[model samples]
Target chain A: MVAISDLKKISEYEWEIPQSFRADMRVPVRFFVTRDLLEQALRDASLEQAVNAATLPGLVGHVTVMPDMHQGYGFPIGGVAATRYPQGVISPGAIGYDINCGVRLLGSQIEAEAAKPRLDVLATALNKYCPSGVGQGGALKLTERELDAICVEGAEWAKKRGYASDADLRRTEEGGRLEGADPAKVSPRAKQRGRPQIGTLGAGNHFIEVDVVEEIFDEEAAQVMGLHAGHLALQIHCGSRGFGHQICSDYVRAFQGAVKRYGIQLPDRELVCAPLDSPEGQDYLAAMRCAANYAFANRQLLAHWARQAFEETLAGGVKNWHLHQIYDIAHNMGKVEEHVVDGKKLKVCVHRKGATRAFGPGFPGLPAEYQKIGQPVLVPGSMGTASWVLVGTEGSMQRSFGSTCHGAGRTMSRSQAKKQIWGEDLRKELEGEGIHIRTGSLAGLAEEAPAAYKDVDAVVETVTGAGIARKVARLVPLVVVKG
Target chain B: MFTLTTTYQRNYKGSVTWGVGCDFQLEVLPFFVGIGKIRYTGKTMVTETGYREIEHTADWELEVWAPNLSSLLETAARGMYALAQMQLVDGERESREFEIPFGDRESLLVDFLAELLYLGEGEGLVMDEFSFTFDGNTLKVRAWGAPIKNQSKEIKAVTYHRLQIRETEFGLVVNLVFDV
Candidate 1:
């Protein structure tokens, strides 16, 4: 176990565990955390896992961990490791099981005061229109070939099918579609699993929440994103479903032998990896992008369903129930991005497990509207807490590889949360607080109790204080749909 | 788990009795009542097949042991279902047979459990009786189960994070990580 005192404090909100902490570690681990959050991380293996991640071959810069970091399977949840492209290794376990699991924010002009009377109806409509819970299927069905197209084209497929608009694609990361997605590299079993789950909001911590923008920190940025105080915003959080899981599983298993062939050694077997140039690595990347694209399409379809829900519930009730696209971003992914390392610009595969890409303004990928404001970084809090809307800063590009924290990271395990809180009671408490709750399983809801997570405000504060991200707006939940 | 085999004998006779010529790793935890038997620590003994819960902040991890590869797979599956809080209906029983290609014990274990998870997540199926016969890189599984009437949690998928089937003094011990 790593003690808090063992770290070399870089700043009040930053700490370092040098490579000397473990001999095998190729680079030091840099933490974006405050003292309190640092202590919260020490209680779990998040830091230790970060140290284990530091051992990945050919790691560049420090292995950066966000303030909301928590221990996951092999890598810490909020970790970012960039390796030299075509030379360094890519570990699927580090990218996580939920490939491209992400958050999508949609801004609306519907005022909370006007929608308050029908919030219950809107929540019910969302639950009814948008599928949730275990084994839930989407409204749309597709052939294996269509699913393959979605695997390669992502949200662009949705646009072609009229599920998405031009503006929606414009605001999404990588234009809601990643290039180099080769469905041939993906398995048939993975395709079969994905065929019927195109737009589902599958169970376990996944959700569609309706929130009212509670506050605005940066007026210009908030206006650019269409976030106004007292207005509603919708958040969709999920991933590639079973398709990504199987793809990741298939590769993680195949890479076990790859590590031996590549002569790479690691401390954790869960951290199994392949050389970036190897066939195993190239195949996994190609397949991972398929899952990534699939996820993008899934969220796009869910957002379309959400718009339908809004129209069905509030079309006649309000003048504008229309939800406009703010931005969509993936929290779990491995992208080949250019960053200056040791004053040398290099294309490195940035593996962000539970972190957000927070590119500063002036990046070429940004839409024309957001070129001056930087990329939007959505950091959702736990149920009943405040979610945040931030933008990347130049400092993030310089230090953290253009990434920020993902959410109010879990402070307790699911078992611990279940043991400590009752789902029914938590639901009641949240209901009492004016947050409508719709969940598939009461036990599942109990496991996601707000008390189980760290303070999102403090987490946001740390990153903003570290100058990696800048705050734009804050949101408070009005209705939450969980599975 | 000793009780696991005993339960298999009581609940699924055909499966526990199939494949007679295989060594059984017989050690059971203290009344292994689902995931409740686990300690809230990272290193708590499940006490069945030397399987124990390893503390993970987000996902679930179990360290399982057996005398050989086959027993190790069984113990790990038992541990996994326990964590998911899987249960079956009493009157409506069902069974399914599966033929899955395997490369090694690690991949075989992942693919096998992934199949079970798919059944549960897709069709609400749960099984008590299971028979696995491995011929080279193939595993033929004959399983008896019922629709999952009660499941407290749902695991997203099984992962290969440091998954290894090792030969130890007592048996083959390995740690499995499940993405929840």
Candidate 2:
């Protein structure tokens, strides 16, 4: 645990744990948090995890944790680390168990008021049309060969199948496919876990919510994202599901000895890693990409289901009920890219766990349509809370390695939340707030009560104030489905 | 009645465990670890009884059982080592044992395994097995793992949040989520 007084304040919103704090640490640990939130964060093991991450081999740039950060297995949920690409190491633990668990948002022409009565119907239709809530399978059950195609093709595969549009591919990070995804690198067991889950919304913290575009911060950017005040939009929060989870689990175990083989020393076993250019590192990277692609394909399929639900519910009332894919971005992943560190443009693999990619405008990877607006960064709040859509900024490049907070980080444990709140009562509370929810269990609902998380507004404010991302729109949830 | 469906795609074949807790076995790792679904029958709800033990496979023996998915998952955590006959000595037994209460079944599965790994790794306590009872949102779990002479795998931390645990007449089912 870090003593609050030991922190060296960088500003009102940032604090630093310098290298001198520990002998094994290769770099200092930086945290972006408000004064109050920082105090709350100190009560958990997340700070220790961040400090431990600083000790991993090949780590470049200071280790950083976002305000929404919370305790995770090896690294803090909102942790970020960059290692030299070829010589540095890749640790599955840094990426997390649910690999490529990300967020995707779609914009529609329909208005919230116009779709009010249909909200419930659409929710039910979506629940039926799109398999959700624990162990649900997708509409398309891929053969081994087809699953391989998905691992390699990603959202492009969806595009070919008419599930995704060209524009949709254009807006996704890495165009919905991370390069170097070798199907051979992914274990057969991991593949098996992903095979049936494609296009399915696997449970836990994964949700598809209906939102009303309540406010727009940047008019031009909002226009590019197809967001309009009072318009209805759909946000899907899920990822590679069992496929990604299995990949991470498989690799973390595989890398257990790699850390020692590479002569790397880590504070936590969960932080095990291997050099990027090494055989083990390459294998993990390839598998990571496979999981990432699987996630893109998974979200694309869910988008299809959402479209079908809207069409079935609206039934000729709204034409072109297709939910236009605004953008899909990954928060938990490792990407090999070139970034200027200490004035040298070195290729490094950036590991973002529970943090979103906020690439500024003019990056080569973006679609032609969004070149001027920057990458869309989606930050979801907990159940019955406000979610925001933001865009990357130039300041991010200079500081956070083009990263921002992912969501309202956890403020309490599930047990803590459950002990304090009743699932039925919480449901009533959210309903009173006009947010409709469909869940597998009432007890589960109470654990996700909005109070269990930090104020997303404060977390978003820190990043926006830090210039890592500029808020574009705030989405108020109308309906939520949980697993 | 919780219904479970398994789909095999490409090289990937997985199952979704949902519905009452009948799919609890799916929540247990090295047993049925994957995706699957369960739907409540809205019919007869009976008294749920369960049992857990480590089963020996051809190569590796693992803790196995059904305890309404959540408890089964929690037991699986201890089962992983108890199958190896590890015991959590009285001296090493945790005074304040870690419990990861999941909101739903999915997160509960993951959280249960994660807790096992966490206890084994963070505290260096080798647990054998655990029993559980659910009270609304709270999952009361008592886990046991014997101390190992030499440890091979170190379990890390456990998470709840999206963690899942469920109950059904098919014999209590749960998913064990590990951060291994």
Candidate 3:
């Protein structure tokens, strides 16, 4: 177990566990969390997992963990680790099973007061249009050839099918399509799973939430993103579904031997990895890109359907019901990029499991309008809580490798949450608070109760306090659809 | 030839019997059961194999114990089904058979459960009766079950996180984590 005494406090919201803490660790571990959050994190194995992640070969700088960190399977959920490109190792487990699991925020001009009456109808329409729940297939069933095309093209494939607009692609990370996706590297079983799940919002912490922008901290930044206080916005959170899961599983299993063949030793088997330049690593990277593209396209299709739902519910009843893309950012991914490390520029693969890429202003990737305002970072709170919209800072680029917290990380186990909270009663309580709820299973809702997660406001405060991210707006959920 | 009389109940602490080779009685208790201990009474005996859930913040972890690898896999499968709250409707029954190449004990366990997850999600099927045959380097399995009537939760994939099959004083013990 990792203790607070093992850490050297850098600031009020930052701490470091030096490499000397463990002989096997190649680099140190840096944490961006408040004292309270850090104390809470000590009760779990998240910090230990972060320390374990520091042992990956060719790790540069340090392993960075966000304030909303929680214990995940192999890697801590809010972890970000960057390794030297070409020779450094990349673990499939570090990127997570849900490749490119991300959040997409859509802003609209529809005022909360005007949309209040139709909120229930809008929620129902969103649920009806978006295919969700366990083992739920989407409307479109693609052929093998079509699936391959999607693997390579990503959200562009959706755009060709009239599911996305130009601005939507521009505002999305990597233009909604990651480069270097090779379908041939992906397994047939993965393709089979991907065929019918292209546009699905899979169960387990994935949701489509409608929120009202209650407060704006950065007025100019909010305006540039088309976010208006008291206006309606929608958030879609999901990932590559079974396709990514199979790809990750296949590689994690295959890498069990890869580690042996490469003669790399690690404390945990789940941290199995290979050199970034090795054939095995390249193959996994190629397959992982396919899943990432699939997820981008997945969110795009859902956004299209969400737009249709909005049109259906508020077409004639309200004026300006259009929902424009604010920003779409992936929280789980491995991206190859150039960053300054040890006073030198180096290309590295940044593996962010449950952390978002928060590129500061002046990066060329941002849309022209957002060049002065930095990349948008979406931090969704637990159900019936306040979600946040933030932007990257130079501090993030220098210290945390351009990453921030993903969401309000879970503090309680699912079983404990289920044992403590009744889903039906929680639903009644949320409805009483005027939040419309649509779900396939009440048990799932119970597991995701607000009490199960840390406070989102506090998580955001830590990041902003640490100067890694800047708050732009705060959103309060009005309707939540979970699967 | 063994006559397997299997009965599946959906009630809390549902019990099922897997009569394999001998007149064996099986029960699914709400909590973890001990390793197999043979107690003969005339011509009938009881076999114990069980799994229990472990606390994990973001995912599901299960600890299973059995007398052998095959029984451990079966108990883990049943435990996974129970975790998902899967229920099968009464109607026509279906049997499916498949083979998995034996690599290591942990890989085999993950592959077996992943195959079951694929079947449950892709074909809407769940297996109750399982027969295992271990060859030189492969595991052949024949399973019987029906379409799923309802499932309350979804498990995304079986993870290899801290997965190790151990030989204990009582039997073979293993811990599995599922990304839900």
Candidate 2 accuracy as lDDT? 0.73
Residue B54's lDDT within candidate 2 is: 18
User: A268-300 in candidate 2: lDDT tens per residue?
Assistant: 666778888899988989989998999998888
Better of 1 and 3 by lDDT: 3
Q: Write one digit per residue (lDDT tens) for candidate 2, span B34-106.
A: 1112221121112233222212100122323454465466445544553222334445444334555545565
Residue range A1-483, candidate 3, lDDT tens digits: 898889999999999999999999999999999989998899899999999999999999999999999999889999999999999999999999999999999999999999999999999999999999998999998999999988889999999999999999999999999888899999888988889888999898999999999999999999999999999999999999999998998999899999999999987888899999999999999999999999999999999999999999999988898999999999999999989899999999999999999999997688898889999999999999999999998999999999999999999989778767778889999999999999998889989999999999999999999999999999999999999
lDDT of 2 at A169: 87
Q: Compare the candidates by DockQ and give the number of the best one.
A: 1
How large a fraction of the reference contact set does each model reproduce?
0.69, 0.04, 0.81
lDDT of 3 at A361: 96
- After superposition, the stretches of candidate 3 with alpha carbons farther than 4 Å from their true spots are B1-47
After TM-score superposition, what is the CA distance of residue A12 in candidate 3 from its true location, in Å? 0.5
**What tens-digit string does per-residue lDDT give for candidate 1 at A277-314?**
88999999999999999999999999999999999999
lDDT of 1 at A396: 93
By DockQ, the better pick of 1 and 3 is: 1
The order by descending TM-score is: 3, 1, 2
TM-score of each: 0.91, 0.76, 0.94
Chain A TM-score of each model, in the order shown? 0.99, 0.98, 0.99
Candidate 2 chain A, poorest ten consecutive residues by summed lDDT: A412-421
